[model samples]
Target: MDNASLKKRDLAVLWHPCSQMKDYERYPMTPIKRGEGVYLEDFDGNRYIDAVSSWWVNLFGHSNPIIANAMKEQVDKLEHVIFAGFTHEPAIDLAEQLVAMTPEGLDRVFYGENGSSAVEIALKMSLHYWQLAGKPEKTQFIALESGYHGETTGALAVSDLGLYKAPYKPLMFDVMTAPSPDCFYREEGESWHDYSLRQFEKMRELVEREHKKVAAIIVEPLVQCASGMRMYHPVYLSELRKLCDEFDVHLIADEIAVGFGRTGTLFACEQADISPDFMCVSKGLTAGFLPLSAMLTRESIFQAFYDDYEKLTAFLHSHSYTGYATGCAVAKATLDIFQSQPVIENNKVLAQHMAQATAHFADHPNIAEVRQTGMILAAEMVQDKKSRTPYNWKERRGMRVYEHALSQGALLRPLGNIVYFMPPYVITPEEIDKLADIAWQGIQLATKD
Candidate 1:
């Protein structure tokens, strides 16, 4: 069907996530026919670069050959099987590979379907472990003020973003929110390290004072993607690790968005040279081809529940497609591509090019900050550069940039006023420059006033 017909049918039957249906009246849905490499073509043949990696999932590229072939092959052997009492080759191999590659001590893997489910699994596991260890009072969780984990009941409880969680507050368990280490609000003269270190004091105080009741302290290591791509120093992670160890509280690293070489390392915690008690991974886990998430935890935590079935110590969690063979096979293929190709090494060059390409934005009168972390680059737009004042949410300035980008043949989705680029790993330097140029022009028009 054509774009108009598809959108009409979609709006009649389906509702998109994180969007208001009313907005579709002004901006019709863009139906994507197919995608190749870093570009997606709509039904009407209009092409746009997949700058946000289709919500930060696509790693290698759209319809990657290796992953496609792997999934296709696995489809014939075993699409899926019961993961409770049975095991499959793809799932076993992926688990072994993950345990080997992930940070030390995360030797067990519990599978889920998506990022939010992964967060729920981690939260449940942490709480269960504490109960099994005879510390049932440790039922609370601590998260950053602006942290965004997921939208499920358990995940939403730990998340502090008001936009998505405010309405659900009545259903969620109250979580202690520590001051965000988002260095964007730091004093002008303070370095990122100093600012992050200073802000860590807040978390330290909160955790230390309430360690007895805190089951785990969850954080999006290095970069907080949903909170406007807010980033901080590695020292904060290192210090948090030390504090978690000292206080006997589990540290859950939500690396769903920042893992798999997105943050210049295999895992963001690697940048801090520390290991978390629990690490929730998804998004790029299956190269955006299929839904798959895994919550990796320490052996001690796993052992806490490894008791007799009748003792009620076993952690009971199950998803129908927990260890689907196709998802596991494609995930294994994604990891294979990472190891076979110079993906991480190449990203360094591409990241440098991206920085240099958008360097001109630093002088933009309405641009507030041009922050970057490896493959991700964000430009924060403001109403007044001197005061770093943001545009009202009702104004939807970022939507202006989004509309402008569509007209210019690049998909530049902004988080509020922060326009970011998180293209597929296969994106070329030339493609990077093209996206940067489109973003620059779009920003100019959005903030034109």
Candidate 2:
């Protein structure tokens, strides 16, 4: 009934994701009773501001009424049906809206249950398309350094992060690495645009040399979320698009974390005015109300597998819960909210507030950089700010900030030494100030060695 009792029961049998189970012995989990607009409350009535949007999924807020009502109504009628032969209204409507909403040429949608599944679908689809076209040797994929796509075997094969992929090396296929256009490594006085352009030269060279065997180049677009919120200029995407076009390679934009107005636009790719061959979207697709994902691609790619079933060219991938009626209903409502409201314009104001609230961190002695992209803001803690030296991973400096934030009734989960804020769209400017103050105090405590 209470937080302590529930957490004790949980630790006895349940294991959490992205966690070391033994750590729970020291820092017990807080069992949440309910969640509302930008706030989560435990059984003891203690509330913590949902600063991370519950792992960057919830768009409008927790337990949003519009999405909730849509799900309820759809479940009462038809919860789910086999997506292979039978179709439902919710799935059809959501697919149509997604096609119309995404970039210009992405005319088809493939359903998946989560972000990682979407990545797997895109990777498989790309390879299969090339093979169907008689290019079986085009099997390799190029991914940016420090990129994190998903943990599935196929998705992990394309991801470059060592922390997640190191242990599973035997299971992963070889993938080519390209230098990321992260602006954090920009030289002194170099603009993000100039540094990003300079970094793209390496990618250009890699693509030029490897395009013959490379099936596709998968990128996180403007910001690499799991890689310490490292960001770069839009020019990188524009240049990458040009290179992919010239080389006859597919470009997969993994927009799982940065989609739905989180990056100052409806989609991050729009900033570069380019349409990728495949675009994977999830997280905000159902507004955190249900699990769903859609991978949108062009009609030409869809036509590749349009042959008779005896030829074996048809793509046979599927999830048991594909095109789930309830999930599709929630996603439709989420898009409806986006269309009916001034979400983008209002987010601009909140983003400005976030920038102003965290600006002073640029002067902190132990903080290396305070970067932002739309509603996402991050402050990187360093052992030596002058040289931009990072704290060793064993030090766990970010855990100190996380602990302090919990004590102050706020959720400020850090990605190693990088503390970030990604609150829901329903959060207010006043709440942003409060969350910023909490993060600043936590940073001070964490950095005080």
Q: Which residue pairs clash within candidate 2?
A: none
Steric collisions counted per model: 0, 0
Candidate 1: give its CA RMSD in angstroms: 0.8
* Model 1 residue 125 CA deviation in Å: 0.8
Clashes of 1: 0
lDDT of 2 by residue, 48-164 (tens): 999999989999998999988998898889999999999999999999999998989999999999999999999999999999999998999999998989889988888888888
The Cα local distance difference test for each model comes to 0.92, 0.93
Q: C-alpha displacement of 366 in model 2, angstroms?
A: 0.6
The parts of candidate 2 lying over 4 Å away from their true place are none
lDDT for each residue of candidate 1 in 141-225, tens digit (9 for 90 to 100): 9999899999899898888789898887889898999999999999999999999999999999888789999999999998999
What's the distance in Å from true for residue 43, model 1? Answer: 1.1
How far does residue 307 in candidate 2 sit from its true spot (Å)?
Answer: 1.2
Minimal lDDT window, size 10, model 2: 22-31
